[model samples]
Target chain A: MTAQPQIELTNIDKHYGSFHALRDINLTIENGQFVALVGPSGCGKSTLLRSLAGLESISGGTMKIAGDVMNGVPPRKRDVAMVFQSYALYPHMSVLDNLTYSLRLKRRPKSEAEAAANEVAATTGLQKLLRRLPRELSGGQRQRVAMGRAIIRHPKAFLFDEPLSNLDAALRVHMRKEIRALHDRLRATSVYVTHDQIEAMTMADHVVVMREGVIEQQGAPLELYDRPANMFVAGFIGSPAMNFVDGTVDGSGTGARLALPDEPSIQIGKRLEPGRKITVGLRPEFLQLASGDEAALHLSVTTVESTGSTTYISSLGEPEIVVVVNGRTDVAAGDKIGLAIAPENVHAFDPETGKAI
Target chain B: MNRVISSFRDGKGFDIALVGAALLFLGIFAGLPLVYNVVMSFQAVDMFSLGTFARPFVGFDNYIAVFSEPIFWPVMRNTVVFVVASIGGQFVIGFGLALFFTLKFPGSTYLRGLFLVSWVMPGLVVGAIWNWILAGDFGVLNFALTGLGIIEDNIFWRSDTAFSLWAVIIANIWLGTSFNMILLSVGLASIPRDLYEAAALDGANGWQRFWTITLPMMRATIGAVISLGLIFTLQQFDLFAAITSGGPANSSNVAQYWAWDFSFRQYDFAKGATISVLMIALVMVASVIYVRSTRHEVRG
Candidate 1:
């Protein structure tokens, strides 16, 4: 992030007649940065990406690319390449033709365009399928061709709109690395849009979590995982989700009393007003098997899923909590187990506002 | 009986039965007329011999007479012009309309549905309406043309030798434009919208996108439309029958009208069948191209 940023969006807003699609979006992407916009469906992430591409117009705001004001400019005038969710490979064109389409439109000589296409094909592993039509190629090959088509252009930015959502799990994992590797080799700025937080966590240098047309927070991947700004983000960023339980501050300011019968009250470092209510948040990965001489919550396990590499245990209680163990466990359904977590691993939130406090 | 019932429920037998029924229908309605026409072209027949199949075999005499007639080459030229002109006019205007309506303005689809009126109306009825529009002295077309200053006088669309053939061509184009527009619209709609978006992001402007994306994707549909247009134009007889009637010394007499004239007006059945058989050969070539183009569709 040296010098000036490559893309700058300021107070962007979009409306479809009476419906507001995007509300006051402000973001900045530095050159050579790979940013992922992660959110649930209908969260305006795709709309924001399309706005950057100029496929959609911003009703009110200033959009800048490489320090040039870009409002009212058509998509063609914007030097950006997008891999559509559908791949959108030209059905009537061979792979080489599809890759060299932009170059040809610029009236580049045949040899030059062919050399460019061939170079991209070599890296994308599309050399063998260069002469094939899109329909004749497999889904993964078409996906590569789509990537190749964008990569060959060397545009100011690369925008990917759920480019890998169509692949199976195994292929999806494989292509994820391929895309990240491609991004590293080519130091162009990229903006990726996806609903999968794991994809954002694994790939992006910076993750922007959006909800209802607003940016909830943006930071490095692990930063988002370790500390979420709000309760919605804490539940969204982690796999298997975080658990919540209601509790009241004990007479002692250092601990909170559980709403259950005959249990040890949870400990917190910060002191709160006695008898104040709070919502407790705990990540599944932080919970462990209870050890002797520690404050622990003993409960009956209702379900155990052993995936060989890790075991997932769900407790049976009024406020059900999940625990992820490192390896295979002997615990089965309806087994009594005690769960323990450190006070530092516990997160407290204002139950009324669902915000971290 | 059990095997028959089971086969009807789920087997190859049911498929064969459906195909057999279609073939039987085609054989009765289409095959019989084509065979009869071919046989009659080789036979010497009169009005009295029309009811019987025992006419004397003539062996190329009817074809020879048809070629040697003074009006034969003119009629052939007229047929070519009619087919070419009517199809060209219909296709260009229709494609323009199709693209225009694809913009999806308010009430556009309903307006397009209204344009289908020309396609659904009987061709003879269309010709009857065009007759009044093309009337010699006070026709609306001539009045509008003169008023626009494109023409200085009221040209006789149905009577004057120079304008009679064009009168039918104009009417025929109007009759066929809507069908072409509707079909081309479907072809335009079938293209995935994201292709254009991708092309736009690839640095292609509107015009370049049209040539690079829209036209190539519409190759199959355009081929089908043009071939179908040729067949429809060749089959166009009502406009000529209603408007010109090949009057003013065979000035507007195309092969189709001449074929009807030789058969019903002059009782020369052999020559009429000879002309129609030649038309069938042309339509067969068009049909082959239509089939090949559809089979080569590049689906996304």
Candidate 2:
């Protein structure tokens, strides 16, 4: 038999007066799974995470942790710990006291609380800094203290609200690795929220892409990257974003050809009705620069940006196209380049609805 | 270095002129009077000799006499009592009101505005209003008490020394509380909301949060309010002048009124200047100690 979910949110809705902040969000996290909610600003990812931790009250719906309803339960009683973006370490408290504050409040024995705090501190490499106040610690050290506070709780679930966003780029990468290692060691169910796609791709077991208070798509990181459900997900999940060319279909059922606005017609694997305007989406990585004698669509190159590993080429058209070529090619501005796009890599969506067809 | 010196020389005259103007104002307004009072406090003079800069110097005889007088110690004691009671009551009640207004409550804004009305009223007006309310004969308080059958007859509020002090305290509490409330309310609002949230998540209950987080966060504001309140309460005069008028044989006489009695009522300017100089010294010492203690608290 399968283990029950450690936390479950059912049909949750949150409203700030007349403004709807979170829609009907239904989610479940099984034991030991790491779920990352990835979205743009104001997408309600942090709000949803706060609600699950009982930091925020939901306007409607039921939240359960370990099979018990959590409505009206304060954050302290929720048996979950959160690491905030700002760390929120008590400025007046020593690192040791900050880690043990919750345990003392729970009426645990003083020795037990101290031992647990020390253990977590040692694990986070903060044992030597236990007596130092938060203001004296570096930003990374403060972040570690925040994480230590969460770990000492032995909570049913862990919530992270952009915990790494405040750190410098190098520290953020280092901390992400540490967090992943900690999760593996603890095997604690965790829900993290972040807007950085790299973070979402690197750390998440399951990525839930949200937009405008609604979940656009949720799947394993690569699955969501490969098969985005709609235009928003297609654009949001990847760096450099998927390029779309507005076009119309020519033939029905089994023989659909996509007519580009400024280039040659292309054949699609799926059938489409004639005269239906559709958007053809292509990831930049799939568009290959072709030679002059090759049978490929011709375009004028607008700009080229070359990194060591890949070169990005922008083409001139009504809806401009960008292509990411592996290994630096000899492409520059005003260069005429031919491009070939694989049919399997193409995504067709209804232009008006922005939905995958 | 030479060029900088030349530039400094060019602007030195204007700077000196500004400094001279400021010094002249201070001499006329603050420094000269303080010097005159100090000199006068050491001299023996009556109202006729007050305008003369030259008077018979009595050394410390005036100070010795004032200290030896029978009414001097009692008036000082009364001033201390009135200041401590009034300022202490104002701090506690004003902080409570500020905290109450800080909460997300219905009609709190309107209530705050209404509370401020007493503070905005002139001190003399407040004293008159309270005097009418606390009067022994034809007073609203006595009438209400008699009508409720709680008392047998009129209570002489101003006649009893202890009751007069308490009555003055009540009026001052009403007038001064709003000042602290406004200042402390601003302080409370300036505290970041996330600190409270952090405290809550750290398992601190309301009282724990208040003592550990709220109080310490508002320490500067509390110190400022208390210090200013003490100073204002110590020098209070108009209320007493309007209401009790140091009535019933000097029973309600505070230091300010006692000094006024010597200077204005008896036309003894020398003794009054002596009392005024002593009051200034006492207030200065209190303020200095307060500043030092707060500085220590902040550093620690």
Interface RMSD score of each model:
0.5, 3.6
- Chain B, per-candidate TM-score: 0.97, 0.86
Candidate 2 chain B weakest lDDT stretch, 10 residues:
B291-300
Quantify all predictions' global Cα lDDT against the true fold.
Answer: 0.91, 0.84
- Top candidate by lDDT: 1
At residue B122, what lDDT does model 2 achieve? 87
Clashing residue pairs, backbone N/CA/C < 3 A, model 1: none
The regions of model 2 sitting more than 4 angstroms off are A107-115, A127-133, A249-262, A267-277, A292-295, B1-28, B35-40, B52-59, B141-154, B289-300
Model 1 docking category? high
Best by TM-score: 1
DockQ of each: 0.93, 0.33
* Native contacts present in candidate 2, fraction: 0.33
Top DockQ model = 1
